[model samples]
Target: MLADAEKNGPKPAPLIEAFRRTWGRMIIGIGAALLGVGGFFLMTTFIISYGTDELGIDKSVMLNATVIGSVVEIVVLVVAGRIADRIGAWTVCAIGGLVTMAVAFPAFWLVDTGKPALVYLGVGLGICALSIPYAPIGAVVSGMFPEAFRYSAVAMSYNLAGVVAGFVPLLATSLTGAANGASWGAALLLMVIAACTAAGSFASGSLMRRERAARPAGDRVEVAV
Candidate 1:
């Protein structure tokens, strides 16, 4: 029966129809990705420049700090992935976003202090916050749609977010300049991005439950990706 369905399943809905059916979750996923990945870009892609130019840290030191953060993030991604599996992806992601938002300003302050140890501590905190949600996002977003259109929905949302997030470094630069070289400007950007992710996480969880409830038991599919 499964093989027959694979060979003879109804053609996937048209693009517009797919979007109409799953727009709620797709929009939530896109918002979450835009903010989550935007925050990640602000921290990773732009942090070196921000630290060196705005905060007066050495360029080499900033580079080392980034490398250290990446290493720490690898560990965090694994742990967070495991935790998301046991508890729930959306729950973990929402918590991560709130924590990131809460720490954004303080993290920047630590970096602004120009002390090497404190700088590392601040950067590590930001990376950990982003990585926690980053781990399980693929699973959450891909699971939002039926199997027939899952790939298109997830890919479109993810890539759309990436396109916007690519500009984060430039936006952060402008924000910092607007604030007269104040790190708070950039920190504020991160806070907003984190808040979006947190809000989207909550919305996505609700939509997931509704989608499941609306489907007949036989039509429900457990998605791994």
Candidate 2:
């Protein structure tokens, strides 16, 4: 019967074994997380709109916030990498996402004041806090596998997430009703973005935890080389 063939299908060759044993579930979880990362960039468009229309910030303030935020993101990521060994990747990234969302409120609030200068500090911090944990996510994915399959599995998950992250902005804009609410609505929509990140992060951490628990406590298998 077809059911019998499906159950007793030809065994995969060694080359394909790696694929067969691949962590498809884990990869999917991270790819979803990447959607939010891509979404973060999408929010930038709204950010610009908020600064100019709501906050009445001059072009210079917006420019400065962006430049400063980039610089800080680089610095903080370096620091985050060093501490990852102690805390584990999921913990660090989850915390990073939370902190990023926590600070986003005030960062966007400056739009109400219409003074872009007031936002530089918050934006810089927001970027760093939000972005630093992404580096650890790839490592987390790699850790789930034996050495042999680690490379492809890890790369697949991380790259897919990046691709998803690219579309986040457009998604956010549409969700927030960019045309209808304009500046004030854009600010409010940031909360939705934060919610997405929180949900993604929660699912990622929980799934990793489940995987970790599934591994035999005394039978550690190094990632497939």
Candidate 3:
């Protein structure tokens, strides 16, 4: 399938042109990226500061918990990828987002308890939830665009998400402060991101159908491939 795509793919066009041609799917792809990748930033990256600075967990303890969560994430990603392969990427993505949204508040509440075991549990759960969509999102976005500029579209969405996700730690900190030491601020942030991810993931299927309907029959074959 990959070889066939490479052989029959359309000539690469400007990134902007690719986006212009499929703006609806592009927007959905970007929304999916923002939440899927950005949720990871909240779970893994912002977690350290959220633990040590705000929750006052020992830095070493937080680091150890993070390591545990990372291990769990590794396992979950593989499992989720396999599940996505069997059940469908968008289905996995949507399920992941909903789980994350449902768990965000309670996970943060567990972390706020300052118990080491609870900390590990909270972090591990958060990482595992976030990793589900993270596993299948590359396939999701790649499938959103035609071969003509699939690479460009995927790069743009992920990179743009990366750029915004880079600021997530700062945003989490600011929100935490604004809430006057409440963990709900950061939790709300995660829930909001997860909501977007779930919504976008479900919407992507229909968007892909629309894109296929608009494409030439030959070009449409690449989408399924």
Number of the top lDDT candidate: 3
TM-score, per-candidate, Cα-based:
0.89, 0.68, 0.87
Off by over 4 Å in 2: 1-24, 27-36, 39-46, 53-56, 176-179, 182-225
Clash count, predicted structure 3:
0
Clashes of each: 0, 13, 0
Query: Can you tell me which runs of candidate 3 are displaced by over 4 Å?
Result: 1-13, 211-225
| lDDT, candidate 1, at 122 | 86
Per-residue lDDT over 137-188 for candidate 2, one digit per residue giving the tens place of the 0 to 100 score: 5665555555455566666666667776655555555644655534444444
Q: What would the per-residue lDDT of candidate 1 be over residues 132-202, giving only the tens digit for each residue?
A: 88888877777567766677788888987888789889999999999988988889989988888888888
lDDT of 3 by residue, 112-224 (tens): 99999999999888888988888888878887787667777788878877887788878998999999988899999999888888887888766666657888777655433
Q: What lDDT does candidate 3 reach at residue 67?
A: 92
Q: Relative to the unseen true structure, what is the C-alpha lDDT of residue 37 in candidate 2, on a scale of 0 to 100?
A: 65
User: What lDDT is reached at residue 2 by model 3?
Assistant: 63
Better of 1 and 3 by lDDT: 3
Tell me the lDDT of candidate 3. Answer: 0.82
Candidate maximizing TM-score:
1
| Location of the lowest summed lDDT over 10 successive residues in candidate 2 | 181-190
Candidate RMSDs in order? 2.8, 6.7, 3.7
Q: In model 3, state the lDDT of residue 129.
A: 90
